[model samples]
Target: MDDGDVLTSAGVAAGLDLALHVIRRDHGSEVANAAARRCVMPPWREGGQAQYIDRPLPDEAGGGTAATREYMLANLDAPLDLAALAEHAKMSIRTFTRRFREETGQSPAKWLTGQRVRHARHLLETTDLGVEEVARRAGFGTAVSLRQRLHAAVGVAPLAYRRTFRAADHVRAAAAEEKA
Candidate 1:
């Protein structure tokens, strides 16, 4: 079978290990191993390496962009305009917009929407909040807007995604309790 034709397991962590293996193969064992260590993940295994993992963000940046990113994450539920973000970063709007895209490969608006969606996902997974409350807390302004954004990002409505992840989380928690 071709490389593209190959198939493997079906779990998130397994896919992480598989990707790590490819990284190790292409970039050298030391670099990949170092990355796993930094993430506090276990070493990769060959057998369980065919799952779907979420893609991670890019590496760190040296500029003030990191501070801006931290601020964005911290204020995910707050109303953030370009001017506000620029002022926070102590840069002019034009310069901040340019530098933010250069550093993150996404416009400020797009990045903020992405962060809000992620925050909503976490709330959906971990909390018993209603969809409208999650929408409000995640700064999407309205449930309709939150539905649109979440549907665009994950190809599923917020409730559906929440049901799936919530069930999985419950199962995992039950298994962990049993093990204990």
Candidate 2:
């Protein structure tokens, strides 16, 4: 996991993720993605090392939902229900659902929800946007939904999460200033 200045990984595959994350963070997604393609790996895997275990790789002939996953990431605010996702994957709804779960160990809804929550948290930490706007952009559609999801995810309201991260950042900045 790439936690700010500290990056840690429990296994070899996770180390690859950590390296890709650093590349994505420093260079940009395009560069990281190209590197991933060169290495024949997924550009990014959202969760921790635990999620990497026992998941099937995309088929050698390239029949995987990776492109759909990338599309989903690119359009987080879009309504990406099972039908839409199935269409994007060019598979039947049942087949897409089964293959997605087999490849990712998570249902489509579950994975999409996790991605939304992660996006919401990123916006909260990095931007001064209002909660409702954050909610909308994160695809929760409403503040109430965002609150429910984020609270379920991190045990805090959106504002509290923002405040905590901002406070920590402020403290870090102040400490760095003193060092300078």
Which candidate number maximizes lDDT?
2
What TM-score would each prediction reach against the true structure? 0.65, 0.62
Best by TM-score: 1
**Alpha-carbon runs more than 4 Å astray in model 1:** 1-61, 169-180
Clashing pairs in 1: none
lDDT of 1 by residue, 88-124 (tens): 9999999999988988888999988988888898888
What count of clashes does model 2 give? Answer: 0
Candidate 2 achieves a global lDDT of: 0.85
On a 0 to 1 TM-score scale, where does candidate 2 land against the true structure?
0.62
Candidate 1 lDDT for residue 26 = 78
lDDT score for residue 93 of model 2: 97
